[model samples]
Target: MSLDVDIGHASGRGPRDLNEDFAGAVRAQPGDRRQGLIAAVADGVSGGGLGLEAAQTTVMGLLSDYFATPPGWEPTVALDRLIRAQNAWLADHNRRRRGEGAALTTLTALALQGQTWTLAHVGDTRAWLLRQGEQGPELSLLTQDHALDHPDQRSRLTRAVGLDDGLRVDFAQGEAQVGDTLVLTSDGVHGVLRPTRLAELAAWGTADLAARALVQAALEAGGQDNASALVLRVQGLDPRQLHDEQAWGRTLPVPSPLRVGEALDGLTVTARVADTGVHLLYQVRAADGALGALKTLHPSRASDPQERDMLAHEAWLGRRLTEAEVPGVVRVWPRPAHASAFYLLFDWHQGRTLEQLMAGPGGPPRVADALTAALAWTRTLARLHRLGMVHRDLKPGNLHLGDDGQWRLLDLGVALSGQENAEQRALHAGTPSYMNPEQWEEGGQADAGSDLFALGVTLYQWLTGRLPFGELEPYPRGRHRREPVPASRLRPDVPIWLDRVLAKALAPQARQRFETAEELLLALERGASRPLQPARALPLLQRDPRAALQLALGLSLALNAVLLLWLALWR
Candidate 1:
């Protein structure tokens, strides 16, 4: 199927002297495979004298600037950059005016491509969706008003394009299917017509007819401000993008091994970094002399489909996490169409891994630095977990301390998403020392709890320079019979509260451990004032039934003797 859509927009002055509502859309031709369709609406602040100018420039700028962005950038990333620039420009103009009317507007924009639709919104211009369902045509509100919730103060906007130096645009993405109709409206139209009325009118005819009808209806309903409507009726959907790593891997050819100074697809290998058994990593330079890390299957594994698929999965996940705006993770670049081989390009990070940092000339990191890094790293994990992913391996070597003073998580080669198959979940994939007890059991699967347990071990090592469970080896499992030595016991300066937090995180039983990264992060963030207690041991009955039964009989006989003595004394 081909990407196709019918788009229309209408604007009217209504009862206002001048129209301050502007809307526009751009549909890329068939040759523009990735650009898809971009649509936006902006409604200028009513009190501002340059309202019309503000609305017009904002819409025009978005329509033109959006397509100029690099094709590799995700729709959300591109929109964020463009809108922030627009906000800065508008804010500067307002600042220079020196008491003249401010140039501020509400913006709502959409980008649809390859069966996915992304929305970027600020202020009160609303987005609505109409979809045909088994029952009937269903309408849904796709945006929340950035205004006060109070009825009397509803007109006051809490956020707008040029309201301040800082801009916070709301972003959302979802599947866009054929027969879906997206509707955009300014306050003038929505405030006058209820959602029910709007949806009913939007469902009547072609995009053009529906758009004009909505604007006219708003005007007829005594709308006091300019009314505007933009509609996009999906005529067809493009083939779904291949998100499966295995499928993507089979479509590309792996490149032959390269020596330093060799170039492939505009990237020159500057140095061989590491041979990771299954994959090879090299420090490469682009045409512009910017450094990047290139990862591909090793020469021996070039023909191995499983190895290729794993590398592809890593690249896909890295890009996905980076696009999500999660900090402290390495970013993977999109594969260029001209590329002749399958390889992942990552933004080169200049820093040592945590393992190196620990063993460096400076020695172990300072307590304060460790605490700061832990908090930031926990946040990164929380973001990953929220996206339904688990980092199967987490250790000092996989955690990097960049020169930019950021703690980045590395290597998604064995990371598991919620959608992973049973076979994928059963794969034993992590440093033995860092793997939680649950992961060692039969049919054990790594999950959020396991990741947190690994984080706890990493922190414990960072603080005390020793593994909590000692250096565990792969194979037949050996259970830890005693609680791990606390961080405070090994490192005198390690806080008692932190020790307790780590203890809870490292609990052998999954149910006894912190269930989520956010929970552990909160405990760390609160620190001393709200210290967490160490995980309590399981009850004797649960731990050992025979021991509990013997203890119960001993207590019963002692209680009987005491009762006989007391009765004799009373008599």
Candidate 2:
């Protein structure tokens, strides 16, 4: 497997855009004289004073150490170590030059190991997983934000590279099926682009073309932050039956006692099998055989108190969505009274995930369809907003693709709905890329406007296949500087009306845009004032798979040739 990557940046109205990004695979060994790929991204923080330093710190560390392999090649661990080193380096440099505090910034990185992916990250950077079978996005938000001073200050980040210490990170392992696309980015892309648009960009064409589509969408949306994206399709996976050393996921043998089409309690366990090492995900059939999903916590995690809460929380929230009259959600159990293990039962989404359906070429859906989907998603969010709930972890994984082509939100394990504004003060929750500018800068609150901004970004991705700002730009390590170009510049095909809608949603001044999903819906219904501009179909932005394969082979052989040449000379 190969890693796909992209980066985009803009000098908005502020001092400058500080977003940074990296993609592709990187691995190094002392003995193996081979080259794969080295990718990195750095976003300088605005307002903090030294944005550029932060960006350089991250990229330089990756470039210097990317190929050097130690005992641990786990992508997440590798990335964390690199970021930590970068911060330490930055601190020393800052003290020598200007003295006092160090610069601030964020970094994101990913490497491909054969068919598997290794990842590392710091700050509000993000990694998305789009898979087959599952609908919407099979995203695993890979990084935890270190912002927010208090529970009411949901926007404030408490951790980041170049900060004092304690860099918050979220990490995990996952499967990448053929045609599955992984989109990585800094806060820029999601801040400006929408998920639907992201899926369209990744799937509407080749990975490369789709990547550009996303960037263009961000530009049109008035990129206030640096934006970039790396869209790569999974062409292969470790077909070798997964091993503990390879991937750490829940595993189980097919259970024979509870065969498919068997009734167990009010819900029937159908097609029972192991999904990962920690849990068993079963296709559930109602008394009438109407399908649903019952995921019993893996026997292993059954012992972890944290995992237990997550399982129970997910079930409770799934049921609540049902109570709220949401579609794409089903909860047969009011609570998990009989759950032998931490478990959750949800309606089994039959259609492909947004990430899955989004694969393939354009001739893709019309912008109107994208807009419709965006509106529907926002409406659902509004329901939560009314309930004073927040999806602290609103990445693609929790989303499902329904048979109706609608984007169904799922996984309420971390959903914030404890009390009125309780989510606002909660410290450091939410996917980084989806967060608003203010949230990261100040220990601010998560308001409807911030959620609206996230919704806007998701829509932007579906329509344009890009984020508002490219991850290539450095994330801010200093203070807020200038704003970015208009999203129209990136993808002229986007309706001006839609652009306006995005612009309003992505406004840096959250108070300026639509305050609620309903308000945004009204605006979307109006559509762009200008007609769609004609443009040539975009080419895939991610490098061609065959091309990448050839490159990998060529590099490996060249390294071998060099070693042979040196040995002969020595002899």
Q: What range of 10 consecutive residues in model 1 has the weakest lDDT sum?
A: 239-248
Question: How many clashes does each candidate structure show, in the order listed?
Answer: 0, 125
Pairs with steric clashes in candidate 1: none
Q: Worst ten-residue run, lDDT, model 2? A: 240-249
lDDT (CA) for every model shown?
0.84, 0.57
Runs of candidate 2 exceeding 4 Å displacement = 1-280, 327-332, 335-339, 362-364, 395-398, 420-427, 442-445, 471-485, 528-571
What would the per-residue lDDT of candidate 2 be over residues 154-272, giving only the tens digit for each residue? 43555566666445555555444566777776666776777666666656566667667776677678866666666666654432221111332221221224567676566777687
